[model samples]
Target: MIHGCRAIKRADCFHSKGHRNPCRSSSNPYMILFGAVEIAFSQIPDFDQIWWLSIVAAAMSFTYATIGLSLGIAQTVANGGFRGSLTGVSVAAGVSPAQKVWRSLQAFGDISFAYSYAYILIEIQDTIRAPPPSEAAVMKRATMVSVATTTFFYMMCGCLGYAAFGAAAPDNLLTGFGFYEPFWLLDVANAAIVVHLVGAYQVFVQPLFAFVEARAAARWPGSRFLAREVRVGPFALSVFRLTWRTAFVCLTTVAAMLLPFFGDVVGLLGAISFWPLTVYFPVEMYIKQHGVRRWSTRWVCLQTLSAACFLVSVAGAVGSTAGVVGAVKLHRPFSGY
Candidate 1:
């Protein structure tokens, strides 16, 4: 996963320079340095062995929280006083309240998909050591707590950010902040975000790696790829693991390079998958597994909600796809070259 991220970064650099061939002479030195760095990162022990990833994740979250607070305060001060306003900082003079409300709702729909980590929690359920019943209860409580905490911080940042920059706010709050006074603080915040994303990428991708490797091993039991295993201290690293993971990384890196607009891709994915993965499936599964009666209020409400989510997902998916197409048209492949 780290290797893939590095590859993406390298590709982005080449893309930025309008270079048709990423391996051109001008990039060779940087490529060598990146390769060395990737090797060092890959050598780090697995999460189970080192357990420092969680700590890093925690620190990253804290850093983000700090950034939100700082930006909110700065924006508020710049706007005039802390008016505790939830409406954006600079509303157009002629726009009606109805228009503002509609815009706010649209923004909410666009961003609500960003926090679909409920499915991710399900993927990592095995990490919980308790018995089935106890584990389920623990996970339920943890999910509730996590959702509440995240919602609080998200609301704080959104409200504060809007209050600060109002109608003039950029899509990215950090970018909107720009190189104002104390630019170094913005640099630190961005660095923290990069570190956070590295850990997040690994967390999300590991399950896919496991699933693919398991399938390959099942299909080709006698292949050298499945047979060769080396003991690296306490970790049993296999040849197949190294090869397939590298391949996976390369595939993702190439994809990212081909579509370098990060926000558009994320929007497309979130729009297409968020409803089914985050809301519809979970709600329907719970109703079915728990044997909720078809006519019951809970069942009816859940089904209605699922249907609504499906409609929203379809709309969001269409909008996001259009956005991507527009971006592609605006920025042609190797246009920088």
Candidate 2:
């Protein structure tokens, strides 16, 4: 099944790149870079061991959540109470109903951005064992549990952090805690985040590797470089793979060095991709797959919801773009951390 899928993907890649070798197509630098990064990361020992790395990543995530929740609650208590902390927090004396609604929509959009991987579950399903139709059911339950747990932590952190710092809350809750004081704890939390992202970076990039490699194999079927492999002690490595992957990693590393403001870029990407990937595509696919009546009450409601989500996504994209532009203007390119 996997081989068949790869064949189809290779064909698609070849068609998209025309008669020219995909590896030689300089037009799609982003695709090449993305593929290279994925392959490069895949070769890393930690990331290659998925189960062990996932456990470590989960531990780091839990540690950060626990620390954030505890500190937020403690700070809120020290501020007298939630009510007391809310005092003198608002910059505006009055806001119109429309403005309030807009703010609420923006908040929803921001939070919903985190749920944009709904379609990726389908990709994950391919990894499930054969002859178990219940795999989908199991995955659904697991997803629900995961989402519930994440939501609980996020709500606790956001509410308690706001109760503690109110309008003065830093964009990153951890940053609100003075870096120099409680320095060890801060260092640990930051280290955990870095560790988590290392694993996450590979997970996100693997599909790109598959996409690119399949195309390259199809385009250069007779190339000896693609077929040739060299033994490196315990591991058998391909020179073609190594060269492209290293180049890809270099490209990404250079880009990161040039623009290190991670949060802004993440917000911009979330805003731009969130609606189509998460809300609209899944809902539409589900409705169609289930043979639901077009424009029926339930279908209409779902469609309406998708439309609303699209609007929210658009608003978020505009807001994030503006924020990026403002930050760029203030700091200038390559000036921000």
- Give the distance in Å from residue 247's predicted Cα in candidate 2 to where it truly belongs: 2.3
User: Per-residue alpha-carbon lDDT of model 1 for 53-85, expressed as tens digits?
Assistant: 656865886686678667777768876865434
TM-scores for every candidate against the unseen true structure? 0.76, 0.77
Q: Taking the tens digit of each residue's C-alpha lDDT, what string does model 2 give over 57-131?
A: 678888877877887887777778873243334436364555444444445446756666664566456666775
Clashes counted in candidate 1 amount to 6
- Stretches off by above 4 angstroms in model 2 are 1-40, 44-49, 83-89, 92-110, 131-133, 176-181
Model 2, residue 233: distance off in Å is 2.5
Q: Who wins the TM-score comparison?
A: 2
Candidate 2 residue pairs that clash: none
The C-alpha local distance difference test score for the whole of candidate 1 amounts to 0.61
Given candidate 1, what's the lDDT at residue 286?
97
